[model samples]
Structure formats: structure tokens, C-alpha cells
Target: MNFRELHQDGCFLLPNAWDVGSARVLEAAGFPALATTSAGIAFSLGRADHDYGGGRVDRDTMIQRIGEIVAGVGVPVSADLEDGYADVAATISMAVEAGVAGGNIEDFTGDRARPLYDLSEATDRMVAAKEAAGGSPFFLVGRTDVLLVGGTLDEAVRRANAYLAAGADCAFVPGAADAATIGTLVRELDGPLNVVMGLTGGDLSLDDLRKLGVRRVTVGGSIARALYRHLVDAARELAEHGTFTYADDQIPQSDLNALFDPKTH
Candidate 1:
């Protein structure tokens, strides 16, 4: 099914992948669709996430990596293009050219003094992205970082609704995790709502979110963080104790070879 159809009725889990290998693994696990995680990609590249100024993972590298992930998986992939790297429409056009079925454009400015763009400007950006998409079957997700950056729920709702009106297939509010907040957002949002799970304080399960009427659930960078934590622990064990106990339950090399083989996998 297409990305937009996944959000039509029931809720679906959109796991984030940082590279071709990760994307293939997630696709093998049977998810109908996948998404790119900016944080995960940055950390894998030895940088920081959400580099709105192109200081960390520059726009070109990010686009190239996104293309790689899309090429690696058969399932539909969504690009998490953070703030469109300051050129919203152009970045989205690049993402479309990269073959992403859909992508997110957030309202975060990356400046502490003014963390989010003004509602008017943000709506304009959404319109530009929609127009850039043209007749392509691209799903445009409008994301608001207001609540994630300490803004009020009312303001978040306002910005999200405005973006939806301007031309967004879905509204993504990342910070609302609790049952009460999520329920309120579901009730208040005029369109499909996407909530990111697995962050700190996000204990709700898929069933919990589905019961709350959420249309989409994503686990932004949590999977990547967990994997890195395991790597760090294994390194410490090998360095401090001179042991290799972390190799337990590792995926067999032959199995991975088969999984990656073009003719068989």
C-alpha cells in the first residue's frame, strides 16, 4: 500500500532506519513502510541530529544517504528531512527525486531564541512543499516542534491545523506521549495525527496508541540510540575486561549474506 493509505484507517508503526543495511533489516521484518531518522543518520555519520544550519550532516550528504536507504528497501520509505535544511521546497524536491514515497518538513528553526517559525511562515513553507511535489504521489507530512520545544498544546494545535489547511497529508506532533495529551491531540487535530514513540517518557504501546485514535506511530531515533548503547557496552567489555561476551546471540554471517543477496532475498 502507499504511504497515504497506511494512514487512512488503522495505525501503523513506522520504524526509522539510518542506512541501507538498517532499512533492509526493517523491511525484512515485514513493515509495510519505513522512515528515515535524522538523528540516527547523523549519529551513524559521527555527527549530531537536527542540524538545521547544515553544520552537522550537510544537506547533500543527507539527501544521498536517504536515496541509499530508499534504494535498499522495497517497502515505501519516508524521508525525515529536518526543517528541509533551510530550503524547504528545494529539499523536498530533492527528496522526491531521491524516490521517497513521502517526507516530513518540520517547523523547528534550530535557534534557541526562536525555536519555531512563525505560523504564517510555516504555513507558507508547507504550501511551497506541496507545490514542489506537483502531481507526484508524495505524502507531505507537516511537523510542529512546538510542544517538543516547550510551547503550549494550544499553539501546537494551531500551527498543525494551519499547515494541514495549507496542504499537508498529515500532522506530526512528536512530544505528545501520555494518554491524556495524545487523546487531546487526537480529539483536537482536524486531520490524521502522527505521534513519535520510544523517546524518554514515551511508555505507551502500539495497542495503547491505536486505542487513542492515533493514525501513525514512529520511533524517531530510539532504535539507533539503543544499538549504539550496546556497541558502547561491548567496547567497554572488550577494553576493560578483555572479554567477548557481547557476541552472544549475534546474527549468523551466512544468514546476513542470504538476506542481502539480490536473487534470493
Candidate 2:
């Protein structure tokens, strides 16, 4: 199914991929759609996620990576366009050219003084992003960092609804983890709500999120972080203890080779 159709009703898990290999693995795992995690991409490139004053991976690099991931997978992929990199519409246009099925434009400004865009400005950005899609099927997810930046839930609800009114297909409020809070957002938002799980170290399963009426659940950069942590641990073991026990649970080389074969895909 197309990415927008997945959000029409019911709930689905949208795993975030940082590169072509991860995107292919997620497609092989049976996820209908995938989303790129800016944090994951930045970290993989030896940079910080959404670093202060645009230090995170530049727009050209991000678009190139997104294109590579989309080309490597059969499933639809959404992009994590961090705050649109100062040009909300142009950034989205670039994402569309990259062939993403959809992409998110977040409201989290890097400045600590103004951690989030004003509601009016954020709604305008969503409108601009929606227009950049040119009425295509590309899903525009409006992400508000209200709660993530210590704002109130009511403020988040308001900003999300405004974005929806401005043509966002989904409202993503990432900081709410509990059932009650999620349920509240679901009940209050004007349109479908997208939540990010695993980012805050929670036990909220897909079933749990489904019960709360969350239309979409994404893991954000949790998977990437876990993989990097594993690599760090393995390197430490090899360096300090000269042990290779970390290879025990690794995927067999043959399996990866088969999975990545062009003919197999």
C-alpha cells in the first residue's frame, strides 16, 4: 500500500532507516513503509543529529542519502527533513525529487532560546510543505516539538490541529509516551496522529499504541543507536579482551548476500 493509505486507518509500525543497507533490511522484514531518521543519518556520517546552527548533515547530503535509500528498497520511504534546513518549501521540493513517498518537517528550532517555531510560523511551514508536494500523494507529516521542548500538551494539540488545517496529512507529536497522553492526542488532534516510540526507552508495544488509536508509530533513531551501541561494545571487547563473542548473534554472511542480491529483490 502507499504511505498515505497506511495512515487512513488502523495502526502500523514505520521503522526509520539510515542507509541503503538498513532500508533493505527493513523492507525484507515486511514493513510496508519506511522513514529516514535524520539523527541516524547524521550519526552514521560522524556528525551530531540536528546540531546547533545547521551542523547536522547538509541538505544536499541528506537528499543524496534519501535518494540512495529509496533506490535500494521496494517499499515507500519517508524523509526526516530536519526543520526543513531553513527553507521549508525548497527542502521538501528536494525530498520530492529524491523520490520519497513522504517526509516530515519538524518545528524544533535548534536555538535553545526559541526551541520551537511559533505556532503561526509552523503552520505556515506546513502549508508551504504541502504546497511543495503539488497535490501529489506524498504524505506530509507535521511534527511539533512542543512537548519535546517542555511545552504543554494543550499547546501541542493546538499547534497540531493548526497544521492539519493547513494541509498536513498527519500530526506527529513525539514526546508523548504514556497511554493516557497518547490517547488524549488521538482524541484531540484534528487528524491522524503519529507517535515516535523507543526514542524515550519505553515498553509501549505496537499493540499498546494501536489500543491508544495512534495511526502511526515510528522508532525514530532508536534502532540506529542500538546498532551503533552494539558496534561500540564489540570494538571494546576486541580491543580490551580480545574476544569475538559479539559475533555469535550476527546474521550469517550468506543470508545478507542472498537478501541483497538484485535478482532476489
Candidate 3:
């Protein structure tokens, strides 16, 4: 499916998936496309988001997981390829061939403490991604970590437009708030707009966002974080009181296994 056309029809809600299981579940639940959540994926593998995919996430492993999700579900899979996962080693061609229909190479330098890459460096990475995506173009979501990092909204806009000129298929401002700013961003940039919808930020309804001209909404690890929070709280309760009470609220492993069962014999 071409993202150019997919992005044009209407607002596409892209709930980020962590692993094949989550991807399949979302697919079964009826999401048209899947984008990997960097935080979710890293957490699943016992790490944190942003370059904690062991700092590199084994390019082959990353590509293979993306391919698996693509094959497992009949939808376009966009990998959150965090800053192309390399400083200078990654080439544009390698990224395009990874079976990803789209991707986000954030300007974040992997630090929740310090959020964006230097503007020039970030633009270069987006350019490399564009060259990598080639003719069978996929949506390259260029994320500016402005609000998340400390860059001003104006600076984010400047960098975002620069990325668009550098060949980004879409521009994502991960921490922008409100419909008005989002509206301004959509108008200012030349490509699709990716707005992050989560608990703290981006609580706008689909209708409101469409009115604001947002092409896509990415729920980056909100679901995963919610689940993780539950697990942590449950574990804390158990460790503090030695009670198995939290187990009552859990999904059965058997049921989960049943859900992953193949339709084809």
C-alpha cells in the first residue's frame, strides 16, 4: 500500500506495536497499518526507549522483526528506526530494503534527559533515509524532539521544514500540544503530519485533528506504558505484602497462546 495515497484519504490512527504478538492483536482488532513503538520494543527486550535497543538493536534483528510483523499482518509496518541506529555507518539503501512501509528516525540523541540531535545532523539523517527509501517510497516520519527536548516551537518548525526539504515524507513533532499548533505545523510543512497522542499530551479527538489537517496520529507506547505500569504496581504490591492478589486481574496465558494460533492448518 502506498502511504502517499493512504495518507491522503483520511486520518490514519497508527497505534504503535511492540512485538509480533501485539502487532497481530492490533491487526486482529482492525488497525490498517502498524508502526513499531521504540519504547515498547525496547521495554519488551528489557530496556528503555531511544537507542536502548541495546544502542543499535542489531540491524538484522530490527529488520527481521519488522519483516515478521509485515508478514504476520496484512498491513504496512513502519519501524521506529531511532536515528537510523547509527552515526555514520547506516546507508540509505539498507533502510529502504528493510520491509518497512514507513519509519521514524527521531532527532533525539537517545537521552530522555537531552532530546534532539544537532539540527544539521538530524537533517542529514533524514536525507539519508529519503535516499534509502528510493522509488518505492515509504512514509519517512521525521521526528523533531522540540517540546520533548527543550527546543522552542519556532525552532522545531524551522528544523521540521528543513527535514521536509531534505526529503522526509512526513514531519513528526513528538511533543507538540493543542490543535492550533498542530494546525499551524500541518500548514507549515509540505508533507503529512504525525502528532503523538498519549495520556499527558495530545488528547484531541480524531474529528478535531482532521479539522486541524493531521494526516496521522501515533500513540507512542501509551498502551505499552499503561500495561507496564500495571505490572510494576502489581509487582510492588506483591513484594511489599507477599500477596498474589494482582494475579486475579491478569489475562490467562492459555488464552494468549490461543490468540496467536495460526488460522491456516
Best-first order by TM-score: 2, 1, 3
For 93-155, candidate 2 gives per-residue lDDT tens digits of 899988999988889988888898888888889989999899677899899989988999999
How much is 236 displaced in model 2, in angstroms? 1.2
Q: What pairs collide in candidate 3? A: 92-132
Best by TM-score: 2
lDDT at residue 215 of model 2 (Cα atoms): 94
Give the alpha carbon lDDT tens digit for every residue of 191-257 in model 3: 7788888848556887888888888888888989988988998989889999888888777998877
The RMSD (Cα, Å) of candidate 3 is 2.8
The total number of steric clashes, by the backbone 3 Å criterion, in model 1 comes to 0
lDDT of 1 by residue, 33-152 (tens): 999999999999988775344457889999999999998888999999988877888998999999999999999977777898888999999999999999999999999999988999
Model 2 RMSD in Å is: 1.2
Could you tell me the lDDT of residue 56 within candidate 1? 74
| Model 1 regions more than 4 Å off | 51-54
| Worst 10 contiguous positions by lDDT, candidate 1 | 47-56
Instruction: List TM-score per model, in order.
Output: 0.96, 0.97, 0.87
Quick one: how many clashes does candidate 2 have? 0
